[model samples]
Target chain A: MTTIDYRLIDSTLRDGSHAISHQYYAEDVIRIVKGLDAAGVQVIEIAHGDGLGGSSFNYGFSAVPEKELIAAACDVTDQAKIACLLLPGIGIVDDLREVGALGVKVARIATHCTEADISEQHIKAAKELGMEAIGFLMMAHMNSPEGLVEQALLMQSYGADTLYIADSAGAMTTEDVRRRVNALVSALEIPVGVHAHNNLSMAVANSIAAYEEGAVNLDGTSAGLGAGAGNCPTEILAAVSTKYGINTGVDPLKLMDLAEEIVRPMMPRQQVIDRAGLILGYAGVYGSFLLHSQRAAERYGVSQAEILLELGRRKVVGGQEDMIIDVALELARKHAEQEV
Target chain B: MRCAIIGSGNIGTDLMIKMLRSEVLELVALVGIDPQSDGLARARSLGVQGPHEGPQWVLDHASEIDMIFDATSAYVHVRHYKQYAEAGIVAVDLTPAARGPKVIAAVNLEEHLNSPNINMVTCGGQATTPMVYAVRRAIETLPYAEMVSTIASKSAGPGTRQNIDEFTKTTSQALREIGGAETSKAIIVLNPAEPPIMMRNTVFAALPEGSDHSAVIESIYAMEKTVQSYVPGYHLKNRPVIEAGPFKTPGGDVPHRAVVLLEVEGAGDYLPAYAGNLDIMTAAAMKVGEAVAASRVSEARL
Candidate 1:
C-alpha cells in the first residue's frame, strides 16, 4: 500500500467563529493557535466565519475585530502558517493586504462554486502579495464535477497555488467526496483540498474519502466546533487516519488533548447532528444558515426545519442570510392564514 | 443626436439594440477590439458602423457622435473617459469606475444633465438605489439601508466579474448618497441554476419608530412605476413589508425594519430574459442617453 500523506489546514478559529457567532477574542485565539501548532498542523486559518471584512450587519459582527485576533494568532504560532479566508465581495483586496501585513501567509480566496471568475482579481492580488493563494469553491455540491473543474480552472488561471472543494453544507456523502476530489485532482496541475462541514455527520468520513482520492489538503476544526453541526473534528480525523495507516503527520494524542481540554470547553453548544443541522445537509443549505434560520424560526414561531427546507427550495446561497427572515415571515403568514 | 457604443460585449450589444429603437438618439457605431465579436457583427447587420478598432474608433469619428456610451471594464473606462471629455463628447459611463458623478435615471439623471460625463453606477445599483431613494423620500430620515442582488451567473460578463468589488462598494455608496441612507451595505450573488433565474433584489431599510409605514409603501410603488416606465420588466415582487424592531445593524439596533423585494425581467432585446441584470443596466443607460440627447437637441435649437 502506498503511504498516503495529507496537509491538514485546521479552520477551528475561522469556521468555528460561525458556531460561536463570530465572538472569538485574543485569549481564545492564543490558546487554540498554540494547541493546533503543537499538534503539527500545517496551516491554521483564522478569520470571521464569513471571511475577512465579514464583521458586518449582514454577517454577525466579530467581538474582537478579526485583525486583532489574527495578529494574536500569528504571534503565538511557532510552526503552522497563519491563514485567512476572504470572500471577494464580502472581503476586498485591501483586507487581504491588511491581514498579510499582520503575518497571514495564506489567502483562501473563496467564491460560490460557479462564480470563480469573481475571485480572479483577489487571487492575483494574493499572489502579488506573496501569499499562498488557494481557490476555495464553496457549496461544491451545487455544481457537477465537470462544472466545478471548469470553475477551478478559472482560479488556477488566476494563479491560485491550490484548489479547494468545500462541502459547506456538508451535503456530500463519501462517494460524492471521492468523485469530486478525483475529478479535481485529475484535471488540475495544482494540489486539491477539501473543507467539509459535519451537517450530515459525514465530515470525518468525507475527509478520509477525499484523502483516498488524491486530495492532499484537508480541513478540520477542533472537536468539530464549526458552522452547522460543526466541522470534521481534528482529533477524530487524526485518530481515524492512524487506524487506516494513513500518514497525516499529526500527533493524535496532542489533537485529542486539544479537543478535550482546550477547544471543547469553549463551545457554546455541543456539535451534534441535530434535526436542524441534518436538514441543512438534507436540503443542501449553506451551513452558516443554521443559526440565522434558528433565530428567524424562533422569532416568527415557525419550525426551523420548515425554514431550512424552504430556503433550500429557493436555492439561497451563502451571503443570503437576510432571506432567512423573509422565509420565516412567509411561512408564519401562511400558517396564520391556515389557522384562521 | 448621434451616439456610439464602445466595448461590444453583452452590455454594449444590448444597448445597441435598444438604441436602434430610440427616436431621440441615433446609433452611429458599435466599437470593439475584436471584429469577430457577436455584438460588432450584429451592429453591421443592423446597418450601423461596426468598427474593430477599440476606443480609438470612436475618437476618430468623435465629431460625428454627440455622446459615447462606455460599456467597457472600469479600468478601461478610467483610461478612456478623459479622452472622451477632451474630444468634447458626452460620456455616459456604464462601468463602476465612478470617474464622474453617479446618475440613477429615475432619481438623479436630471441633476447631472449638463455635466460632460455621467456614471451609471452598476446593474445592482440601478435596480435597488431608486427603491432606497423612494423609502427615504417617504420617511424623510433613513438610518440604514442594505441591498442583496441575486442575478443569474450566466448574465455576469467579464466586466461584471472583474468589477465585483466595485459593484459592492459603488452600490453601497449609492444607497447612501442617492438612496438617502446614513449607512448602507450591498451584496451580490450569482446563481448558476440551469434554467437561469430573473434578477431579484432585496432592499432592507431600518426606520425610526413612529415612521409612516403606509407612506413608505406608497412611495415604493410610485418609484416602481417610475422605473417600469423605462424598463417595463421592473416591478415589486411583493408589497413592501414592515416589521417591528430593534432590527440589528452594524451601526446599532433600529426601531423598525422595512423590506422591499424587487424582480427585473429582461425585454429580451439582444440578451435573454433571464439576463434582466444586464437589461436593466442597458435600459437605464438608454434612459439617461435619451435625456442627455434631448438636452443637447434643445441646446442646439436655442
Candidate 2:
C-alpha cells in the first residue's frame, strides 16, 4: 500500500555474484547488466565478492577485488539503477560512502533482523547523500510474530527508504510470505519488499504473495542464480507480475533472454540444492543464494544437508564461504569417524 | 535413552543427524510449530526420530526421552526453556536465546551447565573467544581491546541472519568474559560476493609499552593462524603466516581471496595479521570446547 510503483530489483549482479564469484570476465557482466537494463529491470546491483570487508577473499575462495568490481559496474551507467550491496561492518563506513559517491543511486545495507539499530548510521548516511537506502533484514526466519514486528519497527527507525524481508533460506511458503510482509508493512511507514528463494520452487509464488499483501519491491536474480536452493527466478517474477498488472517495469521476455543467454553458459560448477534449502523454502530458511552451499558441498565432499548443518554449527552467517568449508570439512570428518 | 530435538530447522536437523550417527545420543522425536519443517520429515524418513507436529505432541512424549535439543530459533528457545527445565528434562539450546550459562567447550565451563539454561554462542564466538583471552593474558600490557572486524564467506545459514546482531554483541560479551577486558567491539561482515567468502577475524590488541614485541606478536599470530583451519580465519591481521592457512573456495564457484589485514593502532606496534588471527581463533575454539565439555559433563546432561 505504501509503494505502489512496484519496483523490481534485479540483484543478479549483486547477489548473483554469489554464484559467479563477482567475476564474469568483465564482458559477461556488461552483457548481463545491459540485458537486464534493456529488459526494464529497475536495479542492476553490483556487489563485491563475498567477504567484502575482511579480505579481498573472506571465504578464502573468491578472488575478484571490490575496486575492480566497482570499476566494472561504473561502465553500465544509463540502462538501470546502479546499486551496491553493503554489509555495514564488513564494508567500512568510508567504503560504503565511497560506493554512494561512485554514482550508485541505491545502497542496500543489510543487517540481521533486530540489528536495525546498528544499521541506522549507514542508512542515515545513504539518505543524506540522497541515495535510496534499503535496510535488508536477512534471513527473516522467525517463529514469533512479535520478533518479526520488532525487526520491522527497528528497520523503520533507521529511516531506510525500504525494508526487505529476505527469505535467504527460501523457507516461507506463500501464505507465510503474505503474513511476514503484511506484518512488516503494518509495522513500518516505509515500503517493504520480499526476496525469496526457489529451493521449494516457490520464489515466484512467494514474491506474488508479498505483493498481494502490500509489498511493492521484489528482488530476484537472473535465472534465480542464488544461494541455498536458488532465488526466485527473475523471468518468472517479471512474467507473473505483468500478468497480475503490477507494472514491475520488467520485460519478461528479455528477462528470460538474459537467463538463457548470459546465465546458462557462464555459470560456475555448483552443488545441487540440498533437501534442507528446498524444505526451508517450504520450511522457509529464506536463503540469499543456494549456490554458496552447493559449492561447499562439492568442495567438502558432503551432502547439502551436511553443509547446512556445518553452517549452522559454525553459526556461519550467510555468504561466509571460508568458514562454511571449514565447518563442512570438520563435519565430514566427524561423520567419517562415526562411520568407523 | 533417546533425545528429542524440537524445531527441526538447520541446527535442529544438524543435532538430529549428528545424534543419530552417535552412539551416545539417540533420536526419539523431532517437533516443530510448523509441520513443514524439513528436518522433521527428514528424521522420519531416516527413521532417526518421531517427527511431531508441535510442542503439544512432543510434550506427550517428553517422558520417553532423556534429553531435548532445542535447535529452533531463539524465540522458540526462549518460549520453551522453562518448560524443558521444569519438566526435569535436560535441554541443550543450539540457538542463542537461553538465559542460562553460555557454554564454550574451551572456556570457564566446568560447573555452569548444571544451571538449567545453557546458551551456545555463535560459530564465530566459538572459534574466536579463546584467543581473545589468551592475547589479553599473554600481552597483559595491552589496553583498549579493539576487534577491528570479522569477515567470513556467505553460506553459513539463517541462524546468522536471525542472530548476526546478537552474534556481534554475544561475541564481544564472550571476549570480555574470557579476556576480562571492557574495551571490546565486534565487527561482523557477511560476504555475498562471488567466489563466496570464508570467515576471518583479526583482533587488534594494541600491546602495552615495553612488552616483548616479537615473541608476543609471533605467538599470538601462531595461535590465531592455527584455528583458521576450523574454517573461520582466526588470525593476526595482515601478517606473514596468513598465506600459509589452508583456506578454500566454497566448493568451486567462489574464489578464496580471504586476505585479513590486522593493523594494531598505536601502542607500540600491531602484530602481523596471520599471527594475530591464529592466536585468537585457536584460543576461542579451545575455550568453546572447554565450555561445551564442562557444561555437558558436569551437568550430566550430555
Candidate 3:
C-alpha cells in the first residue's frame, strides 16, 4: 500500500541563507521558522546552509549573528520539528552537539557520494547526542545507482534515522529521481526523503517520483530559496500532494501566505523564481546555472544573462560551454565587423 | 580488496576498467538489468561476470565480492543500499539518490577507502572542484574572496540530463564543494546546437590591490597541468583565433564572441586559449581514478 500524505521540510533559514550570504538574523530565522510552523510544515531546518559550518550562519537578514536564532527556532509551535544541516568537515562536531542540546530535534549531516564517511561521523556523533540523524547527499545528479546505495547504507549504518534523496544540484529528472529513490528505498528499510530543486522545472515531478518510489519526506523551502536555481516550490508540492490525497500537513493557503509575507518582504519576486532560473530548472541545471551562465558569458564574450537566454532558447544540455563560446566568438567578430 | 559493479551506465563501466587497472582493487562481476547495457557488454568481453537482473544474483554470488558499485540510478540505488548492507557487502556509491558520501577520488580518497559509501560529487564536480579548491587556497589571503566557475552543458554528458531540468543547482553545488571557500560557486549554461558545446570552466577571483592577477591567471594554467596528467582531453590551444567576425547561429542569429579572456592583474585583457578547448571528460575519468586510488581503497577498507 503506497500512501500519499506528506511532511514538508522547510529549509528557509537553512538553505535560503545561502543566497543571502548566510546572514539571516536568528530572530528572522525564528520568524520564518515560526511562520512555517504555523503553516504546518513538519520540519524547520534551522542553520544548515548547504550542510556546511555555522560560521556562515549569521544573526539576521542584515548579516548579523544572534545566539537567539537557534534558541528562538526551537520555540517553534508543537507541530513542527526543528532540523539542521551540517556539512561534516565544515561543521564543528561539538557545536553540532550543542545545537542538538539547544533543542534541535533533527541533525542532518550533509556529504557527497564520495565523502560518505564525513556524513557518517556527523550522523554518528549526532546520534550519540540522542538526536535524530539523517544524511544528505548533495548533487545527486552526479551519482550512479551503485553509488546511491553505497551512500544510503553507510548513512543508515552511521546512525542516520533517515536518508535524503537530495538533488543538491537540482540536475535530476523525475525519472532519474524515481530510479534512484526506488533503489534507495528498496535497499534501505529506513525512512527515505526527497529534496528537489526547481532546475528543469521538474522539482515537483522529481519530488513525486521520490514519493512514488516510496520517499516519505520531501524537503522544500517556502519559495524555493537556495544557491542557484532555488528549490522546489513548497506551496506547489503541498498543494499537489494534498490533491493526490496524500496529506502534506502544509496548509496551502498558509504556505502561500508565508511565501508572500515572510519571504516577499525580503526577496524580490523575480529573484525567488526568475525566467533564467526557470530555464536552468527546466534544463535541470539547478545549482550550476549561475556558474555556467557567468563563466560562459566571460569565455564567449557575452553577458551571463544573454548566454543563459541562448542556452534556454536552444534547449542545450551539459558540456557544451565551449561550443557556445566558439559560436559566440564567431558571432561577436562577425557582428563587430558587420560581416553577418 | 574486491568490488562488484551493478550498473551498465557510463560511470559504472568507466570505474570498472579503472578499478581493474588499480593494484589496490579486484574487479569482480558486472550486473545489468538491460541486456543492451554497453558497459555490461564491455565488461563481458573482458570476461567479467553477469549482467544479472537483480540483487538475488549478487546474493547468490556474495562470496565472490566484497564491495558493490550501484551505478544504476536513484530509485534503484535507494533499494540496493539496503540489500548490500544486509548482505554484509560494503557499498561504494556513484550516485546522489540520498545523503551519500561526497568523494572526489583525489580530494577525499582516504575517506572512501576507509568508509563504505563513497560518492563522487558528479562529473561536473570532478572537472571543476579541484581547480576551484586550488584557487581558493590561493585566494584565502585576499580580502573577501569570491570565485565564479562556469561549465558548458554538453560536457556533462547524457546521464546528467535525465533530469535535464535540474542541472543548475547540481552545477552550482558541485563547484562550491570543490572550491572549499568561505564563499565560492559556479554557473552552468547549455548551448544546444547540431553540435554540442565543449565544457568550459573559468575561475574569477577578486584580488585586493596589486594581488598578482597575472600570477593568479598563471596559477590557473598551472592547475591545468595537474588535470592534464589524468584527463587527456585537457589541452591548451595555440595562437588566439584571428578576429574573423560574427558567425551565424543555426537559427541565423549573429553574436560577437572571442575564445578566452585572461585578466592579468594590470593587463586589460589577454586571449588565453582561442584555438583549442579543454576536454574535461577525458580528464575527469583520470582525475577520479587518482582521487579514489590515492587512499588505496583496500588498505583503508581493511
For DockQ, the strongest prediction is: 1
Model 3 alpha-carbon drift over 4 Å, by segment: A1-4, A19-23, A54-62, A65-68, A75-79, A92-95, A271-275, A278-340, B1-302
TM-score of the candidate numbered 2?
A: 0.56
- Give the per-residue lDDT of model 1 (tens digit) for B190-215: 88876887898889888887789999
Docking quality level of the chain pair in candidate 3:
incorrect
Question: TM-score of B chain for each model?
Answer: 0.97, 0.68, 0.67
Deviation of model 3 at A138, angstroms:
2.4
| lDDT leader | 1
Clashes of each: 0, 105, 147
Q: What is the C-alpha lDDT of each candidate?
A: 0.90, 0.60, 0.58
Q: Could you tell me how far off, in angstroms, the CA of residue B238 lies in candidate 3 after the best superposition?
A: 15
Superposed Cα deviation of residue B225, candidate 3 (Å): 14
- List model 2 lDDT by residue over A1-340, tens digit each: 2333578888776666656655545666778878887887778777653424423233323355554666667677566888777776555456666766677788887765545555766777788888888888776764344676786677677778888877776666687787788777888889888888777777889888888888988988888776656777889888887788777766799889889877867777442455666644544333533454566577657876666654553443454443444555566677788999
Alpha-carbon shift of residue B182 in model 2 (angstroms):
28
Q: What is each candidate's fraction of native interface contacts (fnat)? A: 0.46, 0.15, 0.06
lDDT of 2: 0.60
Tell me the tens digit of each residue's lDDT in model 1 across A1-340. 4444999999999999999999888999999999999989989999999999887656766788899999999999999999999998788888999999999999999999989999998999999999999999999999889999999999999999999999999999999999899999999999999999988888999999999999999999999998899899989999999999999888999999999998889988999999999999999999999998887788789999999999899888898887787788789889989999
Which 10 residues in a row give candidate 1 chain B its minimum summed lDDT?
Answer: B243-252
